[model samples]
Target: MPAFSVMGEFEVIQRYFANSGRARKDTLIGVGDDGAVLQLREGYDLVVTTDTMVAGTHFFPDVDPRALGHKLVAVNISDLAAMGAEPAWLSLAMTLPKVEDPWLAAFADAFSETADYYDCQLVGGDTTRGPMTFTVVAKGQVPHGKMLTRRGAKVGDFIYVTGTLGDAGLGLRLCQGQVEVSKKHSAHILQRFHYPTARLAIGQALRTVASSAMDLSDGLYSDIQHLMHRSAVGASLDIERLPLSQALKDSCDRSTALALALSGGEDYELLFTVPESKKSMLDVLLSPYGVPVTCIGRITGAAGKLELRAGNEPFAYEHRGFEHFEK
Candidate 1:
């Protein structure tokens, strides 16, 4: 193997990340500074969220650097989206096993691309040598008193989800070789897993409409339970109403697809509730965005109880979703 020189911390930052992304007007001080100075728009409240992804846990150890970079930023932005905030700035703390210039370049390029696409600027961060891990801190802005929260759902609200579900979960299984799919289907599923899209537009649009909201990171079953718990309400979900991509349906049986949709995590789609009074206006309001929104359930008065039904028959689910500390 050819010998490679390890880049010092400052050298790595200047070479790969200092000038990697576009500048933002709100960023008073950006990369290369001790800390970022940001200008918050008047009447807007800041929303900040952080997420960490570790190799062999959140992703495969051999995952492409570019995809990893995109996912690192996307997941954090998803949190902002769920709160009806517009992504504005990002900070990344990354740990790598080695300092490979080519790998770092690819990662930074994709990371910068993702930031620019979302109109977010990379303000500041740190790097170190350790296991392959990424911690992204994202900042967003939402109009005062308009941000959605997980605690706002009320009884008689309608539960809805943006975009299709379960593709990413199936994609993970395909990557691990636990399931078989055709080449075309595999490509789509893998893309879903590798480049999960944050539903930022839908979230922003629903700020005034949604009663409660959250991004689906821990599978619908687990995430919806979170919303119910936070809002002190119950839900009655229609399993038949869950959305599945054509690719997912083609790759798995109905039962298998439904199971994946329920328990598969990391979809990053928005799961929200809207008052029944506003249901008639949903189509008119959301049609312009072109994102598919499905009403999957209804909020109930029974706090903390979630029921699943399939065509009027009670349904039972075995898997609750991915739990980090399950014994």
Candidate 2:
């Protein structure tokens, strides 16, 4: 008999995940429930998002379970951050081929700790035996009618992104053995890939100033299209203005770094636009977040089209971002 079979599903949940994370007052009924009963704060809009990760597809089969757990929470929390929401509740559904006690313990510890770091409570989840996969449903709250979205970008809004890009992409390449890096930089790159941070504070601050916003899950090349499409606007991306880390710059040539920044995906950074009127106060407003912001482009009047430029001259590239069902 398999080791996992020794413990029934209910027992596994109680042992590993039932008491994970904080106990939020808003969660009237949490684990051990047919359904979680949650209370929404008055005058707030409920923001919900879901993400899933498959072992072989999303991560290496032998990757650290602790890092995987943190990544799972960070990615889902990033969506809530993009919407300028305060993360409140999380429900996870885990499918595993087999449960190893040590792996489960490490993963649960990291998951619970990460959830608490973000002030989120794990309300409920399901466990089952199957292929290695994990799914999380994150719930957040934003002030009524003040949530930032990708639909309000105006024709002259300046496109901005939080934090440096392309590091996570390089990190992915390093993990796949596609690139070699100095020992000094390898650890930083690997951590960026394994442990991503959700811009929760910056996102909430953006609600008042940003005309439009979304998190970078797919590469910027692909994600910008979605924002532009939703807002019914076009964009002009300045290749020169993209932010790259010193490590990324040292690891590869300018062009390779640019390509990664453009379409490598999984950065989990915030991509947003601010109207011209808000430009002056933007820096002052976002100073508290302590994360760097870069102006990469501006919204254009040309609907359904994206123009790329390197300072003054026109630039062209055709790299698509990560997508599941592309032929």
Candidate 3:
């Protein structure tokens, strides 16, 4: 009889998860190659998304490791949310400077909590020794015939968003020590920056109704610009209609606060457009989801044009939100 031997990493993975739940009818190939093969589920479209966060660029060096871990996972979940998909699985690839037990413990605890909350599980991942960086690839499932896209917006659609805008942007400003955080608003701003809840439920609920949707990871202005460009339509957002957190307004004036809400980044809220007829139904349906849906603008018939209305007059923004290379 031959002695039994243990398999290596690749072999072990193949033996276990090769044909597992992660590989359903939608999966053409599960393992054993440089890349896995997948097919769009029949009647059901696939929604795939990826996000990366570097130590210095996306996050602070000395911040809470647990929150960082949760955010790394949650933000990616937000992308799936934007597509109105039910998150099914995720793969994590992490680069670490060193494996510190306490840090890993906290990070794993937070990661598990977040994944569990969203009913997502980690099916595949890899670890490497290097500077701190984390990347996630999340897979989501939507109804067979419905998946929201950025290019589907039609003129006269009502532009809406989940939750208040600009909190994360305000949080970042406070984090950088640029803006002073009042005693009353300090915790709110810090919490907004440390942990952002992805509007997963709202996204799913809007699938059949929303024409276009995206997460505001950058800022409302830039991300909306993306939606407008993809849809081949222009938009005019009413500044007065933009939602603001009481904490944010308490810290700054109306103009500055509005600008921050418009152009500040890292909000991770869902910006979606729905038909005017769907408004009342959406409002009643989404009330229990613990997220607010606010209509801030409307899509235009014209193409390649964007407008912003501040009070009675239009205002020109100096910058169109955050850009990586621009600064």
User: What is the C-alpha local distance difference test score of candidate 3?
Assistant: 0.78
Q: Model 2: runs farther than 4 Å from truth?
A: 1-6, 322-327
Query: What's the ranking of the predictions by TM-score, best on top?
Result: 2, 1, 3
Which candidate comes out best when scored by TM-score? 2
Which stretch of 10 consecutive residues in model 1 shows the poorest summed lDDT?
1-10
CA lDDT for candidate 2: 0.90
Per residue, candidate 2 scores C-alpha lDDT tens digits across 154-240 of 999999999999999899888887899899999999988899999999999998999999999888988999999999999999999
CA lDDT, every model vs. true structure? 0.89, 0.90, 0.78
TM for every model, in the order presented, reads 0.95, 0.96, 0.85
Encode model 1's per-residue lDDT on 205-274: one tens digit a residue: 8987899999998899988989999999999999999999999999999988997899888899999999
- State candidate 1's TM-score: 0.95
Could you tell me the lDDT of residue 234 within candidate 3? 93
Per-residue alpha-carbon lDDT of candidate 3 for residues 1-327, written as tens digits (9 for 90 to 100): 121133244543344334333334544554445565655445666678999888877877676888987897789899999988888677766677766667766776777677767876656655666688888898888877688889999999999987888888888877776788799989988888789998888888888689999999778887898999999999988888898999988988887788788888888899989888887788777978877778998999878678888767898777655543222
Better model by lDDT, 1 or 2?
2
Best of the candidates, lDDT:
2
